[model samples]
Target: MIGLNLRLHWIYVPYLSSGRSIRLQINTVIMNPNLDDVDRKILRELQTDGRASFRDISSRIGVSTPTVSARVQAMTDMGLIKGYSTLLDADMLGQVSVILTINAKPSHLEDVYERLMEDEMVRQIFILSDSRLLCMLSFYNQVKYKMFIETISKIPEILSMDASMILKAPKENQRAALTDEAGLLIRCYYCGHMIHDEGVKIKMDGKYHYLCCPVCSKLYKEKYEKLRKSA
Candidate 1:
């Protein structure tokens, strides 16, 4: 059971896809920095166990110990290494692990954020472009999943929402995807803020919000079009 503490807030950006050249997209991955084969290997290894030592990572990746240390240090310096966390067993805590894709009234965002954070079940919460909020819930079972939907609906700001169960996880651990190329940036819909991106980092409505590099661009698409229409 984790919730928001109001520590995160910023100007929002939306990530969208276009037929433009790939170079532009690469520029958008600034937050993630850059990587090479060695860096990629280091990242892959770190995902399995974040607590792995630098010397161990160096030997495994066939790089000098100092080289591995420098890469790891660079990643942290660049803010790519968000942090290391332990995966928990939600079931043992009287909760079930579930995924939720939310759609809410745009204006009542703070209200929505507050409501979701009130629950101890939401270990993670992310806001998406199309006026949606995504949450991983810690509840008893599917029944609690449904109850979550019902409870959120009580707020008028919550127009509607749907959720699903995570059956299998290719990568059960959490870490930013590293690559030589860049990833899309996203916005936290709650406060209209930018979220760092790394390889399609955000999702909503069973669809990947991979098209845009920033969440605000997606959210403002209609506004941009409306202006063009009036012009």
Candidate 2:
């Protein structure tokens, strides 16, 4: 099958007393596996409400409940649907949130990243194009926040660190918008290569697997079987 570009538009309402909402729209380009219209509809419904029931989606999308369930399961197996989560408000929980921009020496970038990952206060991390690390951290109070910063200051690999307190978040959206041009991209299960076309699909151990070529497919199957036997 060929690739497709999908566009998705949805409304996002944050769970706050501010009585605010935002309309999010974006065009998503999905590479490597083919997704039909039915699949797109299912995704749109789920992205709008992760807790939406199968029957609810079926009624809205004009599909059967079984079809919706099966399609969701298939997409989940393909690693397209990671999982669902509930968004929580840090401000409501009386937590101090801070954004930390850390610049580490090129030679010790990975080491510094791992060190930060071990800290319980770190919530999220992103690597910027300039090799700087952007970290989102949360602490219960100012005391804990100060202690955490003091500890991080001693890390020799860290060249510079800047911290900014988040006073307020007017809008927060964890869900991504899908457009007609958006498609889900899947990688080869064995080689980790992006699949541009309909690659070989294999099902083993009740799980779906995709491979870029026949050679990798054979090798992956053999390895899987050997590991299963050893287990």
Candidate 3:
């Protein structure tokens, strides 16, 4: 945990449900902190029940309470484990989920991104190839949704945008596979995205990591080597 410096993405999104809208702030930190079998077990248990006490985790993982506490504290200190929180039902709250795709000028990518981040209704943002953006948005009613569209239209370099409602989501935040499937599948070590045909596979810290692209692969190798040399 000593050399860990993770990327924490903060999102402030609107939860629209039952014609009511509320703000929901979410932070997802992706970190690669040399985790072991015990650490993965602890995380699995925590994901199953975040309210589970250290004593309960210790019993499940077959470790002492103090050991579990120390490991959890280390991960927390490293910013890998932010905090324990409960999930709320957005549909019950009158919130509808939609995915917004936008095409904009390459020069305006950064500016348009910053502008989009200003709206609390924008939950997650992704900049695809060629200045295309994919965003997750939530809105309460037609008035607000139209207002959002009008506001986005005012952006000078934005070309077009398409919004699609998410009717159902079987999995939202489930990251870890139920079994040891990492080896069978190609995944990006940096962003944890599933990699297709194009990727860079490299060995780091005595383990193999496949990055989704050259950029992430280069960054991961440089950071890993720098940390290894310093250590």
Among these predicted structures, which one has the highest lDDT?
A: 2
Candidate 2 residue-wise lDDT, 1-231, digit = tens? 233344342436453577786554432333357778888889988888999999999999899999898888878977778899897889889999999999988888889899999988899998876668999999999999999999988999898999999999887765366778777677887899987765666677788787765556666777899999999
lDDT of 1 by residue, 30-82 (tens): 23323557777887788878899988888887888988887776566435566
TM-score of each: 0.54, 0.79, 0.60
Model 3 quality (TM-score): 0.60
Tens digit of per-residue lDDT, candidate 3, span 1-231? 222233433333334455555443322223343566777777788889999999999998899999888888766643457688788777777877889999999988989999999999897898899889999988787688889999889988999999998888777885446443322234577878876544555555555465665557656766788888999
The C-alpha RMSD of each candidate to the native structure, in angstroms, is: 14.5, 16.1, 17.2
Query: Where is model 1 more than 4 Å wrong at Cα?
Result: 1-33, 91-94, 141-151, 165-175, 178-231
Q: How do the candidates rank by TM-score, highest first?
A: 2, 3, 1
Model 2 CA deviation exceeding 4 Å by range: 1-32, 229-231
Off by over 4 Å in 3: 1-33, 175-231
Model 3 is weakest, by summed lDDT over 10 consecutive residues, at 1-10
The lDDT per prediction is 0.61, 0.80, 0.71
* Candidate 1 lDDT score relative to the true structure: 0.61
